[model samples]
Target: MTHTYKINGMTCDGCRTKVENALNTIEGVQATVTLNPMEATITMEKHVPTEELQDALSAAGNYTIQMTLPPSHDGHHHQPH
Candidate 1:
């Protein structure tokens, strides 16, 4: 499953890299952190608790992560070409 989280305390590209690297360490987790939105989208092979993600970030730096609603697909849909 894929999870999106809102992250705080990231101030620059370096911060973003740190967050991403930290999250990626978790088993079965692939994370992408973006600076502008200050959020991380993690793709997991299995369900990983939110707390686990939080702990990883906390250990990495002065960062925090909270589970957030995934982006809506209200109107956008893909049509096979």
Candidate 2:
């Protein structure tokens, strides 16, 4: 399965590379990190828990990762008050 995560605390290209390498170290995981969006998209051979991903990134730096939720079918992110 593939999953996208929002990464926080990345500030440069080097930061992006560090995150990418850290995540790719996991068994059966291929990760791509982008700086502009500050996100990582991972392709895994099997299910990997979000905690594990967070742990990997934490060891690398002061980075944090959270699962990215897909946009709603209605294409809206917020509701009227």
Candidate 3:
């Protein structure tokens, strides 16, 4: 599954890398972090709790992450009703 989240406390490209590296450390999770939008698009093998993500972020730095609306980049396309 794929999920995007709003990431806070990033100030530069290094911060961006830190956040990305931190998130990617998780098992079966791949995250792409952007500084402009300050968000992380995470692809996971299973549904991982937000708390687990938070834990990893905390270890990397004083960063916080939360769901971005919900499945904004979950690789799903829907036809117009």
Number of the top TM-score candidate: 2
As a TM-score, model 2 comes out at: 0.89
21-57: candidate 1 lDDT, tens digit per residue: 9999999999999998999989999999989998999
lDDT of all predictions: 0.92, 0.94, 0.93
lDDT of 2: 0.94
Q: Write the per-residue lDDT of candidate 3 for residues 43-73, one digit (tens) a residue.
A: 9999999999999999999999998764447
lDDT at position 2, candidate 1: 80
Runs of candidate 2 with Cα error greater than 4 angstroms are 75-81
lDDT of 2 by residue, 17-60 (tens): 99999999999999999998999999999999999999999999
Evaluated against the true structure, the overall lDDT of model 1 is: 0.92
- Considering lDDT, where higher is better, how would the candidates rank from best to worst? 2, 3, 1
> Comparing candidate 1 with candidate 2, which one achieves the higher lDDT?
2
Q: Mark the 10 consecutive residues where model 1 has the least summed lDDT.
A: 69-78
Query: What's the true lDDT of residue 28 in model 1?
Result: 97
Candidate with top lDDT is: 2
Ranking by TM-score: 2, 3, 1
Model 2 C-alpha RMSD to native = 2.1
